[model samples]
Target chain A: MTSSSLIKSFERVKEDNRAALLTYTVGGDPDKKTSLNIFKSIAESGADIIECGLGHGANIGDGGAIQDSTYRALSGGIKTDDIFEIIEDFKKDYETDVIIMTYQNKIMAYGEEDFIKKCISSKVSGIICVDWPWPLNLDFAKKCKENSIVFIQLLCPTTNEDRLKNILNDAHEVVYYISMLSTTGQKLKVSSDEIKKRFNLIKKISPDKKCIIGFGITADTINDFKDTDACVVGSALCREITRSINEELNPATNVGNMVSDLKQKLSS
Target chain B: MKLEKGIPLIDQHDENGYWGGKFGGNQIAESLNYPIEELTREFEKLRNDETFIAERDYYFKNFVGAPTPFIKLENLTKHLGGAQIYCKLVSKATGGAHKAYNAVVHSLICKRLGKTYIGGDTGAGYAGKMLSMAAAKFNLKCKIFMGTKDVERQSINVFSMRSYGAEVVPVNSGSQTLVDAVSECMRWWTSENEEAHMCVGSTVGPTIFVKICAWSTAQISREMRKQVMDEFGEVPKDMKLINCVGGGSSAAGFWNEWIDYDNIELIGVEAGGPEGSSKHAAPLTNESPIGVLHGATQYVIQDDQGEIEETESISAGLDYPGVSPLHCFLKETGRARYTSASDEEALEAFQLVSKNEGFVSPSLEPSHAFAEAIKIAPKLSKDTIIVVDSCGDSAKDSKIIAERLGYKI
Candidate 1:
């Protein structure tokens, strides 16, 4: 029930009156060591919050972009426990708030209570999973709150405003407003007016709740969602890392450049 | 249905909340953000609708031939010696096997859910044929994702699906078979179109889909159980029920009712591939450890690194890395027994039944189960009765099995 680290991270970003920049990196993408290095570089490059991906090879939650991203991580022999080593490594260099956006299977296999304990111990500020079946999982959401870990809510565009109001009431740390109904890497189909309308509604309902737009928020398109509190850069950055790994280049530095370069533009 | 240790949905998850119990967990009910209650409501409403049931009954009786003849395989029973073995002639159903039941039900549910585009993955081509036909019957656009290799091998099956005015998409991913096709189907659902509901052709998925699919197929068990009671005095003393399992949809339906039966026993057969080699789809046969993949927790066939290992079997439908989560629970709790028959044994059973019974082509999936039945039937008492499900027609598998066995059919 106390203030989560994710809130502090957002507060730190707001010190300059700017939205926090969040990046998602699936652990063991390509390899574990390089993934850790990429995390450190992205954290240093100016990400206020970093979201790590978790799934046991089969990703039924996110779009195929993340699915393909997980394929690389899993193909690299990444397991759930390996994520701990990578997180521990990243925590050494930066206080960037860490959140694990994972599939429910990973948490279920690791044991939900045990997973929350690990999240707290790993200094993970927030947790969101696709498999949590929403209201059916509200009890676990309470458990997460008791453990002082923020249970981030995802607001889809397809959801009506009434539902958004209800979801906003329980939301904490951040509201991940998916910009469109499409998956990650799809063309931005929502107009700025609609994005602004939805974001404004979330803000109007709970100005206290931080709202960040995700899904198809690329480097160029990120400008459209500038009015929101933050934009989650996942598939785009992961794609850069994938390109680096595929071409035998330094993935950590290349992805570092991708985020750092985007950071400068978002700094506006 | 109550059993000694397991229920279909509850026991499948072993205190860990995997509806498949330690074996299956990690299921997305419908879409990424779909509320569980809505999906549950749809299933409940559709399953109970009087008109839907009437329509379902009408379709099964007239089109797919439901209540398929539960007949004693007199020739095979006499040859096996000890017990009188019967076959639940599902192979005689439309789409040439037990696949018609689940496929038609899936089609109905998809149409009820107002899904415009119905998409899913299939390995054996039987399901694809059934689903596409259902889609065509219901006037819904259908697209099926099959493994590139399976589509090529089961060319006639692909043709059958397409002939129903459904599009056949070949997935050329890892292994280029069923598992890869499932992955592609999921990707297609999440990435391509969120509105298009996945018509998963298995009894192993999220709680709602698993429960509903099994519930739909339970009609088979209900019909057969009634026939068994009518034909025999009561349930037979040594009644053994055997069915082939890729993802265990038919077995789920078959065992759903018999779970509470006192004298009836359930046996699930896995594809053991060619003998003396580790290349098999036998998750339970090898006592596979608990793992999660493709959205459910089940006994997954995996290597040391935890990556899903490829499954190799004579039947493409049986060529899956995992079985239903319920089967895993049944095996782990000892409520049901699991055994695997090798490709050679299955082929022998296929030829044996085809030659004596003159039942057209039978798919390799049920052939594996019939092989196991053929194995134990002789060891039991003469008064004992055993039932093996002729799960699918072999018409789709004819060319492949013929080519593999060096027969020019």
Candidate 2:
């Protein structure tokens, strides 16, 4: 997809007054079918975007809950290819945008161009290679554009202007600005005003692109996007889904309930 | 003619030949196999590379003050009544220890990798000291993860590291010691910003680290060669090189350059702690079988289930239950001999050295090396030249020894 198309999607989501529900689930958790069910449930529950997590042997960004989910997924024979199959199934059934978030090794192992082509064929809208910075991954961004897949760039609080400028220049679909210094599933301790201020700075720098604040975001803080284009809630939703699966509850029903509650909270 | 760049030196043997048959080529976990293998290959090229050799030679000769004057202890030799006793005074090295050589190379590699921050695990107190020096010299942000218990014990070194602008992170994990500090440092490297690189403090893992550490250690042997020529008018025919094995860096360093020599006997003195053959010995010498930790497969003092076993040594430096992979390979190949020294013996030797040489070498490493020398000295003639690495100065440890032994310093 072109940069203009991504801008259009961002504008449409912003105009609908709907906080984009970005869901994250480890591919093939418990089993492929169960994980696929979780993905379908999220898409059906009004998730505007899905992040299919490609679990690495060493997950630097994950906390305990997501770690356990990934362990369960791996033990159930979930591999990288299994994630693509699930994404393909989700695409056949739903019209939501899917993004693959993984480490650079995974992409390099699968061959970056081949991985991007697989994502395009599976109807994935974007890709987030976590460990690859913009300056280091300019060639990767070019490949993504050639394959009609948006290359998402991650920005953290520690990122200075020089690095941010590099990221904004290469960013295609959305800018995922991390709200806090810590990892996902952590509490959102930073103030909404502070987050808004950072988002405003990012927005001013990349005026045409959608800038979203992620990492440690929850349903309670969905309204923190008053001055931002989008707020992506991932780990919180993944945590709740994991809690349901661990408690032996119906994951789809529990996920539906959780997303509905989040929708209501976001709207209010 | 201009020398191009890096060159490969060490012959590429089958994994079993170089790794003691414990670390087979295919044994590395699938995830880390490529990077580690690539690193090993790169290291082979760098090891013999003319520039690397020249840089190593220059650092040893100038920076470390190599040919660290060999001191013959007439009193100790006469007291023992056997072989000629000599000490390779590594205490004269910059940073007051032999670790400076390896730390410089590690820091240089991190800088080459574009890492602005360098983190290391400290137990021998050498990594922190040497890396602190490297950080200041190289203008890199340095973080040291030291065991809380070790921090309390080695306050002077900790203070020195801080003085160098290194952030000393005290780790209170399992056993609150070096192993725990290493694990915590690895975790920190994974979680922290990607711009930082974790410098393995020893020659235990990647062949590149081993090669660099070995090059640093070769200073001792190189100096010994010169000393032998100066004293005996030739290289001594019956010479033995001795150093203590703590995570096996010094031992590997010394042996790496001399392993190909047919006549020299390379002996690694390991900590026996309180238990000799039972629990407390370092991994390569005692409990560990063939298993991977960090990056290389070596003898690890691990449990039946392959979990890393906790170690206890009076000396914090020797408490790690693992040794360098090349040392493991040497142990298997019969090129280098391995021995153990009890805490009691090491302490006794420490006292002996202090009284005889008027120099107290701190940490059990030098004492352990001395203990081995003492044991082996009786079997050899007075003309035999033996080199034991006096790894560090004992000024700091003297206080602890006095307090523990009820003696005045």
Candidate 3:
């Protein structure tokens, strides 16, 4: 496999003996200019990778916070092209690997082959489609691999052994293990030890592939999975953005500080 | 006549999960994989099981009153004076709509799968009422997620569900309607899947859901096929089957048996909103692009940027932006045709049907189909025959009808 920035960043984090911190934020949220600034702050605040959400109409996998972000971004007229532009501008200044998180329709509606071409042009490192699970993602994963982009696979606690093995076999650099059975933003109901147990089982199957736990991961809970390869924090940051907007504060600075605090919590 | 197992309209596509190699697929998040797989395995086995078939047939005959009357509409046919019109009064079924066919079967499957909690999402509440009734029969805990707006519009159904011991939860989210309700129900099922089985109301959602709904309601076509053969010597060569297409459960059932019959032409009618208005729920007729919504890929009404657009219609049940993936497949393969009826036309049809035929409380959803039948009945040859599935009673639509007709009720 060709060396990509996503793998290199994971290796760097692994050498530091700490889990990588991947921050997720919707692109063009609040507004286009403020969102770009927010991305920069997240990267500077020690987020190893940035998962920029592409605004969509319906995000069934997301909770209220991320859904609110998507609605705000969409009502502000943020399109797929606008998100690509945001990523292009963000890449010019930061070395932080960026991945686009979107629903399948956004890619399918844009034409699959043309979407990949745009991803390469926009300097996107990888992609995670919330609704595209397992073998359905096989063909798209192949297209993404041909273009040197990491297509992240999502596995839930309910995934059976056969399906899990199939997914991991086709998985590329990163696989997202949903920490629970709820949507993003729900409180972490499962104990950290249980999460570790699940992670250990996956490791026994594919020790080489890097897996990240997402959904319900917040600053209060970030330290729980410190022993894992990486952890993704999404809805908590989106909630912070909402609170910042409501409090009449600079959202970029507030969200940036929150990410910094999350990094601090993980490291401590 | 003894009720028996109904045939599936198409072969099971286990490879990619897409129906007709294009429309339907299990385009859902991973959190739902286990529950869907469990339901799929059990349902696939039970659908063909002889004991299960007999149990469903027993309920159809003794409980919900299946084999609803298929009668010639003499007055309206004489008034139109062109084609022979027949009405399949599915509205006479228990719970007052064709929704009972799918709902009762789903509840039974829920029992067979060993789940004690049954849940679903409803737009107009017919689905909620039917499921609630079935759940009461099966002695399962039932929860129906309805949009806040739908709760207000479909209060009668809400009352019926509650009377049957089902809790109705109102969701106040984006576009409080059928689409949001389905999303919320899926979210609920994700966390509660271990003990609960979600009963989807229509032939929408993941591949398993589409198959189950279509298979359950295929009983409608089974009865229709027998009635046609027994009534007339054989299937009429110029026969046309018409039904409303909101997620298309009733229409799926009404059209399943005739899919392979070259002699029969199927017509699906969708809500066209107010005349001359841009807002409507006619996704298939309006030329929507293929997009995934509520778990399945189908023709969805979306903006140029691929955002799901709000749909408007006189009837709450028909106010959905997406159509069934099966309907999309049927349309693409040219085995079926689709059209639309405006709010004005549907309202007119409601009045005419109620006044002339004395079929009071014909639902606004099927009124769209009635509008089309009324329109073309005069233009076809006298030998031509059209069967309209009067799928639901409009007791829940009294408020909308009152408001539209400018009456206090």
What's the TM-score of chain A alone for every prediction? 0.94, 0.93, 0.97
Candidate 1 Cα errors over 4 Å, as ranges: A1-4, A109-122, A135-148, A158-172, A245-249, B1-26, B29-37, B191-195, B233-235, B284-287, B302-307, B328-335
- For B1-409, candidate 1 gives per-residue lDDT tens digits of 2234345443344433354334554455223444334556787787678999988888878878878778888898888799888888778888787667777777777777777778878898877888899889888889999999999989998999999999999976568898888776766666545467676778666556566667767777878889888898587777889999888888888777788665778899999998887878999889775666676767878764456787788888888988887777677667788889999999999998888677634588899988998899999888888898887888888887889789898
Candidate maximizing DockQ: 3
Candidate 1 residues A1-268, lDDT tens each? 2235678777777787777788987887877888889888898888878888874555554555666678788867788778876887778777887888876656766777878877776777778766554454567788888889888777776666676777777766576777775556676777867888888888888988898777777788666655568888898888888788779899888888989877877886
lDDT of 3 at B20: 68
Question: Where is model 1 chain A poorest over a 10-residue stretch in terms of lDDT?
Answer: A55-64
How well is each residue in B229-262 modelled by candidate 2, as lDDT tens digits?
7777966677788989887777665555556566
**In Å, what is the interface RMSD of model 2?**
10.6
TM-score for candidate 2, please give it: 0.62
Measured by TM-score, how close is model 3 to the native structure?
0.96
Q: What share of the true interface contacts does each candidate keep?
A: 0.22, 0.00, 0.63
| Residue A127 lDDT (model 1) | 81
For model 3, the local distance difference test gives 0.88
DockQ, per-model, please? 0.28, 0.04, 0.70
Q: What class would a CAPRI assessor give candidate 3's docking?
A: medium
Higher-ranked by TM-score: 1 or 2: 1
DockQ class, candidate 1: acceptable
